[model samples]
Target: MALLAPPKDWYHPAAGAERLWIGIALVWCFVMSLMMPYWHFRGKQNANGTTYTVTPKDYLERTEKFVAANKVGDLNGIPIVQPAPGTDIYLLGRMWNWYPVLKLQKGETYRLHISSMDLQHGFSLQPVNMNFQVVPGYDHVLTLTPTSSGEFTIVCNEFCGIGHSTMIGKMLVE
Candidate 1:
């Protein structure tokens, strides 16, 4: 037991190499801290630091009504909502579907309101590589401006349920 006992002088001096590593880590941490405020002020950044003012039910009803009034028909079995520029657009995420494929114009910005109906889903826009986590209660609003005119696919990158792989949506910029 004495052979395994700890040394009385436990405070050993660290090498210069170890001190250099600690100094580098402290500097790196300070630089990363500035990114928080930078992203918060810049609206162009894709960051979710918002809260839902209304419940999911209320949000869903609003989306449903919007879809009903502004329905432009279906694209590949998904309902298409052609909203004007600067208008608030809703994209609901459910068990295995993303309702109402959105249609927007290029070079124009639009407010995209996204949420979930049942469970959390993934709101991913292809070609541009934009992705957002769709929560049930929180309504995440994303301001998007399509620079290119084409048909882009929306993929459900988050695994929600058994049929998650088939959960696909569409977005058209014209």
Candidate 2:
């Protein structure tokens, strides 16, 4: 005996629904692609400004207060003066290494304050993420935001001398 088959229309239910889903998906992808480049360009422009310096104690204190008050903490474990939005920062130091390892969330924005203590050294991030010059007596600030969450290595761009490559740092973003 032959088996009976279900109705042809029943097997293909809601043909319009498939079209609607595809349309929605396309629109979403288009919007995201457009926004991603726009955000990246805007962030790059913002990162080209100056940054200020603050004492490490003051930086920690302000960060604590920001946490207590439910405000955002943008301090990156550096004793650099805070920069106003859209402004670059300049920090000065000698053979100093920033502590407390910075942690940034996805989409978070930051302006870096970098300087040297004793000799002329370099500050460079691995994977060629961003570029900044760390010179003695002169602080350089670069604005940056990690769009993705992961671990990145920070390497000295300048070749001061021996142990320059060993001067490594780490950045974490969630």
Which number leads on lDDT? 1
Candidate 1, which ten residues in sequence have the lowest lDDT sum?
43-52
Clashes of 2: 21
lDDT of all predictions: 0.85, 0.55
Distance (Å) between predicted and true CA of 152, model 1? 1.5
Tens digit of lDDT per residue, candidate 1, span 67-150? 987789898787898998999889898888888888899999888899988888988888888888888888888777888889
Positional deviation of residue 173's Cα in model 1 after best superposition, in angstroms: 1.2
Clashes of each: 0, 21
Q: Please report how far candidate 2 places residue 25 from its true position, in Å.
A: 44
Scored by TM-score, the top model is 1
Per-residue error (Å), model 2, residue 136: 2.0
What is the TM-score (0 to 1) of candidate 1?
A: 0.82
Clashing pairs in 1: none
- Candidate 1 segments exceeding 4 Å error: 1-6, 12-15, 53-56
Q: Give the alpha carbon lDDT tens digit for every residue of 1-174 in model 2.
A: 147775666555446889799889999999999986787787454445564454544544544443344323433543222233343323332333433345555675666566665566666666756666765444456666667777766776677667666666666667
